[model samples]
Target: MTESNDGIDRRSAAPMYDQLRRLIVEHIENDRLQPGDPLPGEHRLCDQYGVSRTVVRQALGQLEHEGLIERVKGKGTFVARPRTAESLVHTLVGLYEEVERRGGHVHSDILRHERITADAEVARALELDEGAPVVVLERLRHVDGDAWSLSTTWMPEDVGTHSFDVDLREASLYRLLAEQGIVATHGVRSAEATVATHEQAQLLGLTAGAALLRLRSVSRDESGRPIEFFVAYHRGDRSRFEFQLDADSSRGELIRIP
Candidate 1:
């Protein structure tokens, strides 16, 4: 092992690659490197840390996998921007309201807003009979002018009729429902990892098979009746979900997802 004067201690039991990874993390955490800042190239890193090219490559690969850095084919590697953090474990807020609360802009492009027959899955989620008439609203949501999520919502025909009168591109579904005496007081939400499909990829500006976070939720009104069911796909690389757990409680409290 080559001795390193720049914090890569060859005498330590830890591996050289791991030591380098920690060093880079420290630089990022200490603000020595800011987002979009270019990192040293492989050759420069090899000389600066007195390590082999293989060690540097391993460290950079690990960092890229962890979303701390991004490597451009010709522009070299740069520090990655922070992911958008959303908390669905504590508050019942929509994406538009949440992003606006954080001083970020939010908008949506209405894709589909017509009444359609509810399929088996949508019917089950909304507690309606199969083949029942339901309102389907699809939107491609954007945050700060970047494609963020694709959301599809289903509601019973009676409740969704009010939506046709409003321009949903700039409207909030929950607020619209509230105006019609349907308020979502609580909901059950679940999240899972999924790959972007061809259609979804095109709408979200990602390649097919890219990582995505799928969020499904069933919202109930104050009367304990299911009023809304929605499925949303969020870009995994740009979005992150946060949760707060209490050791004393057996079940974690979850809020609604928009």
Candidate 2:
């Protein structure tokens, strides 16, 4: 025990509560205290630091707010276990695969899957003329058994045909597509913050006028062939996006490609 910490004489110049909070946190950071370790009781803290009960409580409040400690209902205040990295949302790893990795239950329900003529937007994205044959697949995704997002895919006819197999209901569609020879090697993605339409909101079991994430992307195969055009409506409350940035030494990065 240090002489100064044991008898911390409060000066009129410095605030006592904030100083106490920093002193306690520094002890934790230096491995003097660890998670699951108990903190001194409120009365004991007030006595040790020579501070008022109010000052001790206020300092503890800040520590709890910062997630450095927790006050259990019956048990006394204890250090908190730090949180680990969690995925915000879908990336190239496949939506189903990514969610499970984050400790969330995953499910996909095929709402509609059909072969139809391409609409104007689909035609343009797929690089096909209007009325070209296209396979459209609609799916509702659930995370932890709650409705989370909706995905719609438009597969150009040049891509392998789409079908409604049992795997589509309960497995990764990307893996299924890979087995069928339409491997999605890479994609060009665009994301924007948007409000859900009335129809979309209803399907997602959300309020009629709600905010959502509108994600769209075009995936291609090894030969640089545009095969799949996908639009996903992700719930803002239940979804987020993550980006991994690494140094790219190769200056050959394609600029203005979007």
Candidate 3:
């Protein structure tokens, strides 16, 4: 057996694959491996750790499942980029604002921005009559120059007309609304797991049926009037939502899926 420089102990009670997984994780945490860096080939890893092909494969599989590495078909496995964590539990903020606050660059490509008749769902969410005129805004959001999410928002005619001429590529919608005295003071949001559609996959640079996080929300103004309703599809591999819970609260919260 080849001697392992990363301290893979065969005498320990832990399985060989787990030990290998730990070593690889350490290499990543210690900055020996950075995001997008190619991981050693399976055979090379097996030789380095004195393990069989099966053991190496098992260890690699575990790492991939944990989002530590991504394996391309023709291209070898590489360290995966870190996921962006978004706070959804306590804050009423848009993606652009949240990303920028974390020192990340955000850009948007306006896909569609026009006045449209509200559909049933849109009308209901905005508390407007069906077929009422509403502003529809669709954008493909990018983070660090990579496609990250597709967002579609509907706002009341009075509220949305002001945004038609606004440049929103690097601007926050919430901020723009605030300029017009339409601040979103509170909101309800829900998320679900979904697979990307063919069009969505193409725009987001993912294979068809790739995992996505679907988020839907409705924002209200200080006067308790609904101002905006939006649906966003985020790349699941690159996005994570965080929630803070209070165990001492007298009432537990329940999220209803619509």
Query: All models: lDDT?
Result: 0.83, 0.73, 0.86
The residue-by-residue lDDT of candidate 3 on 1-258, one tens digit each, is 234545778789999999999888877777677888987879889888889999998998888767788765456878988888998534789998899889999899999999999989999899999999999999999999888999999999999988977799988889998988899888888888899898998888776776788889999998999999999999877887887767775575677755
What lDDT is obtained when candidate 1 is compared to the true structure? 0.83
lDDT of 2 by residue, 163-210 (tens): 654467778777777778878777677667788787887778665555
- Candidate 2, clashing residue pairs? none
Ranking by lDDT: 3, 1, 2
- The lowest-lDDT stretch of 10 consecutive residues in candidate 2 is 249-258
Q: Rank the candidates by TM-score, best first.
A: 3, 1, 2
**lDDT score for residue 10 of model 3:** 72
For model 1, residues 163-218, the per-residue Cα lDDT tens digits are 99998777777778788888889878888889989899888876677678988888
Instruction: Candidate 1: list runs displaced more than 4 Å.
Output: 1-33, 37-61, 70-78, 252-258
The clash count of every prediction, one per candidate, is 0, 0, 0
